[model samples]
Target chain A: MSGHNVVAEAFAQTQYQVGGHGKRIVQVLKDVLNEVEGTVEGDMYGSGKLIADFEAKMAEYLGKESAVFFPSGTMAQQIALRIWCDELGLKKVAYHPLSHLEIHEEAGLRELHGIESVLLGEKDRLIQLEEILNLQEEIACLLLELPQREIGGQLPSFEDLQKISAHCREKGIRLHLDGARLFEILPYYQKTAQEVCALFDSVYVSFYKGIGGIAGAILAGSAEFTKQSKVWKRRHGGDLISLYPYILTADAYFDQRIPKMGQYYEQAQELAGLYNQCPRVTTWPEVPVSNMFHVHVELPKAELEPILAAVYAETGVGLTPYVREYDESTSSFEVGIGDRYAQVPKDALHTAFRLLHEKLQNL
Target chain B: MSGHNVVAEAFAQTQYQVGGHGKRIVQVLKDVLNEVEGTVEGDMYGSGKLIADFEAKMAEYLGKESAVFFPSGTMAQQIALRIWCDELGLKKVAYHPLSHLEIHEEAGLRELHGIESVLLGEKDRLIQLEEILNLQEEIACLLLELPQREIGGQLPSFEDLQKISAHCREKGIRLHLDGARLFEILPYYQKTAQEVCALFDSVYVSFYKGIGGIAGAILAGSAEFTKQSKVWKRRHGGDLISLYPYILTADAYFDQRIPKMGQYYEQAQELAGLYNQCPRVTTWPEVPVSNMFHVHVELPKAELEPILAAVYAETGVGLTPYVREYDESTSSFEVGIGDRYAQVPKDALHTAFRLLHEKLQNL
Candidate 1:
């Protein structure tokens, strides 16, 4: 097997590991099934209590006039920007070069909506307020992703975010928050969801990410914004005849996990500290700002794979699923702490890390 | 109350109705939850056994090399047309003016993909072969909806469909089947899905419609075509982390109902005949083509609403949920027969129709 496969096998074989509770469709929806009546009508084409009530709750939580549930965050964000651009009579927007829209969606913003995206900041860091001021393009909207996920879940201080919001408002540039992990960052900021959402003209949150729902998103903004999104949603085909499966799970998990963010954030910090103590192992951000961070290893993937597999087998603790090669001499993997982290025996976890440290020293 | 609300309340009160099985989300998913294991991983970002196996089954059934599950048929059809347009180097396509793409989707094809649609025929009928031959636009594709829905479920002869297919093939134009209700029309065509699919370059089928699935669609075609669609699916954010909810229900309901189309069609015809016998009442095409037909009542909505509501109240057999005003003098409502038809007591249904006939005559 290839090195990646070997690491994956080790991760899969172990009884104890890190990450969120499993994503089994059955397990994710088990609790939700009990709460719903079999005879109750499911929402049809976005009209029914199942979806409307959840949207209302999320809208109130985010302090927006209205919110619309969407099939995916990608569709919601693209539409959010498209709405802003259409309103401003400009088909241009700005976001970080590493934003999911810029790099991950196959340039859907450009190809599907004919909207041009202006890359805002350098790849490795968050978008600085100075960068927003220096933007050469006359952009209609600016999109900022909270806890910039591609950069190891790094987050800017809340004060900086406030300044950026003020500047964008003065410039007449609509600000949209790509807050896919919005719930995860709340503990670090020590702020309510409403406080953070208040910084932008529009916001999107993913239920499947840190909340551990099956899949869905909430695009919240003004009533007019949501009404327009409904039309664009139909255009994008995001309006499923029934979105209750997503809504039900999102409601269950959001309520279950939102209050536990502080716990997960502390667990992530403790876990990252264990890795940093090991030889040749380091974590981006040095300490985690939320429930996730990236791990960089000094050894190449080919050289490091067997050692990691051996550690998992001997210690019965899986550290990472796969180590990705950055170069022939370096590799990395991401770790996100959740309910699973609490399940690992503390003694076993420490022994696994000690073994991991010894193995790296030997290398 | 408004006329529409009165009719709606009457329909809601009746225990019997003429439509498919109820779309209660829990009921639709109850059986599926039992068959799946809680530990089995849900598909993540379109990866896992749950989605893959279902896609394989659909592709095999449709006689295609591959298929992909989509969140909605609107996204699938738009992406299918975009693919053909992209491959042919022409951003133009053709379909009936009342095609879902032309009317229902807020012109997503034109707005999102920059693709132009050439309307092929009059609003009141399916596209004729002669219209295909006389197309004024050099188009990349032609979309055909079996049992054309908007025109009251009318269909041309199978021989006519074959000729249109042959001509489109010869002209180098791709043919796509908007087979939203492909299974419903099979008894009339006397062809298996494969034989019907053999005539088209691509196909999109909805699970939520006649199948009574919660919501989902399948886009099937050549391996290359499906591969391209996957990319577009991601772009459109149709790739939910787990589509197993849809996939499982679709698999169950499709198997449960595929054998019942002939039954539903017969029920529809019988139901239409009763309406045709009533004064000033007519069925579109005056015959049922599939399991669905439009009922046109030659009275102003204001006049027809109370009469129909009274019939439902007196006989406890609801013929329709609402009547749509076509004009001040005429109103229409669609009826689709499914499991519910078998539930309505025969004696009550006859009495309901007799009452409906007497009321219409009194008008």
Candidate 2:
């Protein structure tokens, strides 16, 4: 197997996964399956009370008028943009260069929907209000990802977000929130999910990322938008004969995890502080805006991989295995503090870091 | 509630369902879940041994070099055409006007992929080879749906299919089989799945339609085609965190139902004979090409609905609840013989049709 697979296998065998692990995930699914009543079976193509209930609940939580469950955030967001552009008769959208739609989706928004994305904002930073004002082209929508993932879970100030939202409204440009991690960032913004979601005309949230569901997403907006999205969902082949597993798990996890965001945020802060204390380690942004941040270890990935593996082998504490090499001498990796992180005592995390530091020092 | 919803509710309460019922579906899922072992947890987004094993098995069964599981057939078939068109630098494909891509998918093949579909055949009939030959535009692919659904599960003869396939091959056109009910049609062809599938460049098969899985599809083709499809799958948001439920169910059902397709086909033939015996009813084609055929009742849908409901209320045999209005005085509905149909005896079906004929005569 490849090195990544080897590390993944090692991580899987470990007792505690920094994020959700396999056994725990299966148990959660089983528990949710058992608890799901009345609508044990969903519609043939995602059009029944089970999915409707989940969508309604999500919309209510996010303070949107309606919501539609999607099998993936990628499809949800792509269709959202497509609908916006089609309605406005404009083919252009603007977003951060590192947006999931721009980078991770293989340019589907362009290749599939003929959506031309105008990249705004500097690398590793939130899009500034000035950047939106500088755009010359007629654009249908602006996609904003809360706690921008590629840049170590960073977020702009609430005031900055308001300014951008206001500008988009004034220009009659629809704003779409790629809020895959919206739930996780709310504590940092000290805003209700509604307050954050209110700024966007449409919002897409992932059930698996912060909510700990097996897999699913909810795109929330006006009932009209959701109706159109349902048609798009079917076109995209996302309308499964049944979505009970995803719905039940998302429902259970939403209730379980939404309230725990503050704890995860706190844990992230503690982890960041510990990493900052180390001489050779530094966190991008120095403090995380959400429950995730990137840690840059001055050691190269070639050296860092063995150290991480050794740490897991010797201490049975599995830290992140994959590290993106910045250059020949340095590497960085994202650390996401989830429920699994809470299971490990803070001191053990400290000890793991200390061992990692010592191993780097020896190298 | 709408009239359709009311009818659906009544159908749900009945003991005998024309298709797989909710209770039985849940039981099958539970049984499959219990049978799954080793890698109970799949890859983060459909990249583990469990999914791989299922894909390999499907590919081998279909006589393709490779296969990839998708969350839905809409996405699978769309991606297949997209890849074919992109590789050939052609933007057009042809299919029967009533193909699922034309009617059901909200024009995603065009709206999303910029693929212009040339509707090749008349409604409710197989796409004739002559029609393909007369097409003026240079087309990249030809999508053939086995047992045309909207027209009554009709299929061209095996000789006709081979002729079409040979013509396409000579013209450098890619043939894609939208074989959603491929297993069902195999008995009529008197050919193996491999023999039928070999004619197509790529084939998309639904696990749920005839195989009785909850929901999923496998796109089988050459290894290179599947490799590109994986990228498209990710772009389309088909790469779920885990597909264990779908994989397990599809695997189990493929084994359970594939061998029994011949039996279902025979039963459908027997059922069609009984329907033809009814004075006020006629089976489309007079004989089914597969395990499904259309039953056209001389009575209007409005007049027939109550009679069917009354019959179900009096006897436990539940006939179809909804019927397509063929005209002001005629209506038709499809009869799909599945595992559920196997549960009902031939005499009961005959009695139900006889009663329907009596009721229509009285009206």
Candidate 3:
């Protein structure tokens, strides 16, 4: 299966698509209105009690003794790395090249936190233990994103992960997990959330991305660390009042969707198996270690647009968030298995791929 | 007027008593649910845009060219001062000691932007042109808060304001208006909102403080300045999506209450006149230049609490947000006027003050 075909298949199964259109405005309105009237005073100055409760609950759920919520994952990660640097008396964090904290946090770590990043792994490779071992010193923390979102949701092996965690502990380097997609990765790794979190000194999770909550991120750590983090949270203007709505939504989703992550993992396995039989598409990591997989399309960039449009028009689903040049102008696309993709039959993916292949072959 | 009398009079005018005796939870819930929504998208990202049109309209109403919305007046002023600093290559902003930006922005200008502030005028006096002239070097900007919330809602005379504006212009220092309570000040100033805004390069206003929207602020400026501000807005994570609810509420209040500020102003003057005649109570600035006025009551801390509690219990209205020890040993109280306070007749306040005086004298 080529990347083009992979994307075509994914587009044939968008969950958000309702009869080939957006969710109804009335539903959106109802949800939004509820948000406007929060459980307590949601203003910045007032609602201190609500914020305290939300933070406390977030801490308990994340398996940390304490936590503080931030407005964004960018701020949470940047602040975590900064804390690690200050604590370890070092200036650099070792991470993979595709880390979200590095690429998408808008240079905030460099500009705001004044910490440097050492990109340790090869551009296409995950941050291996070898890279961690090569650094003798000058590293404050080792950041690992389980099921890295950017390079297709691939996770390091459990044994490899244990080694990295142990190495960091031995070296007195903190292990910080950018667990934005940790919920999606849990079932694939056959681990409970608490078990995985035990490996890291601090973990940052986003409520908005996979949890379906409104915007917020929680940085969970030791009680001492989180207590100190309150000062920093206030300084950054992330100390919001009345976070009950976000917390309630996260709680509701935590029970319903978290248990279904295993299902997504199973569905992703089936989707990957369908692609494995095809020659044109090469799957990254051979198999997705999580609910998402990236397909390297062996097609020209010029053919991507029309094919994608045709797939959406014919199948009434748009799968990919973005398609771009991966190497030497060759196009690549990433796909993630969610509720919508699970609804589409595996045969539709096969059919979608065949149609995409026919279209690309003509080009 | 004695603080005890004020408290007693406050109780005598009660529509209902305190301890959940005044307002029913059902009524509170109904009003809140009907007026506000349950889940506001935390749309801090482009939430400003929903109010962008309203802000532009406000700018026009205030006789300005443009406006940008902020979650806080502190943020708005700090960002404005930062822009002035960046634009003029200056390191310091001049403001009064009690300026909210200097005291309340939590030292963000110094900690985050590395900019310094020079407090002008007497320690607690309205900013004067004489203080501006005494500044040793070029400064980035000058901040003036009309009816300064911290200092008993005081404002300078129009002639004095014009003089200060001219002085700043001659010195090439940008002038900014911290108009969080500007609406309340306008009727007392007997001038249009435009007249006040015209004296400054930037003006900031609030929604919840006086206009009584749930929570939001606006920063009005020139189009070019606001364009640069949009970039800053995203940098600060202030861009929110779908701010229609806050916008709609702000719009409703702007139309309904803005014109009524004059009435509040008239009531404030009457109350000030009544308080000035009292021996134990001191009214600052002689008369309030706005709907908000602060009364300094020379009462013992222990004596003040019960009377205030009684007032709130009997009247179902707040006489003060709190009782603070200006000096831990010396007892002092501050009174702020709100819609509730305005509804209480001057004689009620006089009677409350008489009761307070009698109680204090007996003590």
- Per-residue alpha-carbon lDDT of candidate 1 for residues B224-333, written as tens digits (9 for 90 to 100): 99999999998898877788888888998899999998899889899999989999999986888899999898899888888988998998888888888977899998
Q: Model 1 misses residue B341 by how many Å? A: 0.4
The lDDT, on a scale of 0 to 1, for candidate 1 is: 0.89
Candidate 1: where is the Cα deviation over 4 Å?
Answer: A1-4, B1-4, B23-25
Error of 1 at B303 (Å): 0.8
DockQ: the better of candidates 2 and 3? 2
Q: What DockQ, between 0 and 1, does each candidate earn?
A: 0.75, 0.53, 0.22
- Estimate, for each residue in B1-363, the C-alpha lDDT of model 2 and write its tens digit: 245643555665676665432243355566666565533665557677778888999999999999999988999999999999999999999888989998889888887788999988788567776787777789999999998988889888888889989988999999999999999999899999999999999999998877888788999999999999989998888988787777878989898888989988888888788778777888876898888888888887777777778766655677675667888988888878887877776676666667866776787
DockQ of 3: 0.22
Residue B303 error, candidate 3, Å? 2.2
Among these predictions, the greatest TM-score belongs to 1
Structure candidate 2, residue pairs in collision: A112-B112
TM-score of each: 0.98, 0.94, 0.83
Q: Give one digit per residue, the lDDT tens place, for model 2 in A138-250.
A: 89999999988988988889999999899899999999999999999989899999999999999999988778788889999999999899888887878877876777788
Model 1 residue A112 CA deviation in Å: 0.5
TM-score of chain A for candidate 2? 0.93
- For model 3, the TM-score of its B chain against the native B chain is 0.84
The prediction achieving the highest DockQ against the true structure is 1
Cα lDDT, model 2, residue B9 = 58
